[model samples]
Target: MRSIAALFSMLMPGVGQMYNNQFVKGVVFLIIEHYDNVFGSINKAIHLDFNGAHAEALKAVDYQHLLFYPGFYAFCVWDAWFHARAGADKTKTAIIFLVGGFLGEFAAIFSTHLPIPSLTCGLVMVIPMLAGMFIFRKQ
Candidate 1:
């Protein structure tokens, strides 16, 4: 159920989508995070090669990076967990996030490409996250 997605989302960002019966959204988060992790490892591997630990250089990418994005991943998963435990209307929560989640996800995505600071993308997401909480925060 969506509750499952919320748990996954906490860890992988968009995992809650799958539980919400929204695999496409889940896949989007999954792919993006995967891509980022892969590149980060590649960077570490290259960094280590230069340092002369050629054989085990690739091991520099801490084991944590292998499964999740660390801080961001944990934050997202926790957010999902709280949402799952507190939701009053899973349907509305699902709908709002399924659509608004993209704005947040892609914004965070695009934000990475930016050279300066901005909160537009985060604001887009926070609004919905808060709305989801409000909607489900018990009548």
Candidate 2:
């Protein structure tokens, strides 16, 4: 069940929360995710920047709206996973998730300035996040 919820979240942020019967949170996640993806503004900026359209990409980027995406996405996944586990401990879960989500958001913000590929930076951020998840896992 936990794995399924996690997997569902991987597909889309809120589905796992819905699976866990967290309808309100799931809706919030879905709304945020949809807002991030619908216009694809950030994504378009990234794509354009990657393709060497720096000025156009800068014009396309919407920092204010983009900031909400990473944290929300990460939080929903972590929240859903915790809820999925039958006897999961809540201790420190929020902190661990906050750390992970912030790191992810930082990566997203830095990707534009850094010479490294965004995907690579995202993968780098995931290492610590995965480690933290394991480190804080229910015993």
Candidate 3:
């Protein structure tokens, strides 16, 4: 059961915890990170292009030769990696971090309306892991 939470974290960062019954934490992350990151990036995409087709046609994002779409790929990996080495409370911790991640991204989104919720959510989610860090450190 705990492993399932960790696995979900790996797949979507905070999804594991939410599924594990950490609804509050899960909602926080979803709102904070995923919403903002995706929206923010897409918002940028909309503005970066002069016409709809320009942004639409540019299926690839290139910033100094680095190209990647904004999503849960990295966070999923992070959640999995960290959770793998995590303790018994990995699921609980995943939920909190997921919440924090969501909060941070929500802040960003509300401030700029940039659609950065998704990317920011992933980046900020690890913050709530402090709870897990404390939990693990106690042992």
Candidate 4:
């Protein structure tokens, strides 16, 4: 159940929450995720940057929304995992997830400004998240 929930949330952002019967939380995650994707212009920026359109890509970035996305996304996965696993304090776990998510957003903001390729920037975003999963993982 834990694995399934984590995987589902990994695939999207809120699917795992829904699987765990967290309808309101799931909807909230979905709305936040989609809002960041569209309004943040991150996807568009990434696509543009990858295609060698540096100026256009930079122009596409909506930092206000983008900065909030990484953490929210990570938290969704963490929250789902906690809820599915059982025997965990939901409120406490959620607070931890929120902090981690914010950190991820900060990393993302920094990575974007660095002199690195888009792929590397993506790695910068993912590597810490993967490491964090291992670090915060339950036995």
Point to the candidate with the largest lDDT: 4
TM-score-based ranking, best first? 2, 4, 1, 3
Alpha-carbon lDDT, every model: 0.52, 0.71, 0.46, 0.72
lDDT of 2: 0.71
Question: For residues 54-114, what per-residue lDDT tens digits would candidate 3 score against the true structure?
Answer: 4342342232111122224334433543444435455544555456545654543442343
Candidate 4 per-residue lDDT, tens place, 1-139, comes to 7767866987789999999999998998888888888998878988887888876777788878777777677777777888887686666455555655666665566754655434555555455555555555663
Candidate 3 least-lDDT 10 residues: 61-70
Models, CA RMSD each: 10.2, 3.0, 10.5, 3.2
Off by over 4 Å in 4: 89-103, 115-122, 132-138
Backbone clash numbers for all candidates listed: 6, 0, 21, 1
Show the colliding residue pairs in model 1: 2-19, 5-16, 6-16, 10-76, 10-77, 11-77
Predicted candidate 1 versus true structure: per-residue lDDT over 10-126, tens digit per residue: 446677755665577667867877776686573565455556655554345444443334334434543454545543555544555554566655644454353321234435655
Question: TM-score of every model?
Answer: 0.36, 0.74, 0.33, 0.73
Model 4, position 77, has a per-residue lDDT of 79
Tell me how candidate 1 scores on lDDT: 0.52
Q: For residue 5, give model 2's deviation from the true position in Å.
A: 1.5
Candidate 3: how many backbone clashes?
Answer: 21
Across residues 12-125, which tens digit of lDDT does each residue of candidate 2 receive? Answer: 889999999989988888888888866648678768768877667656767676666678767777777788877777766666667767877887677567554345445654
Full candidate order by lDDT, most accurate first:
4, 2, 1, 3
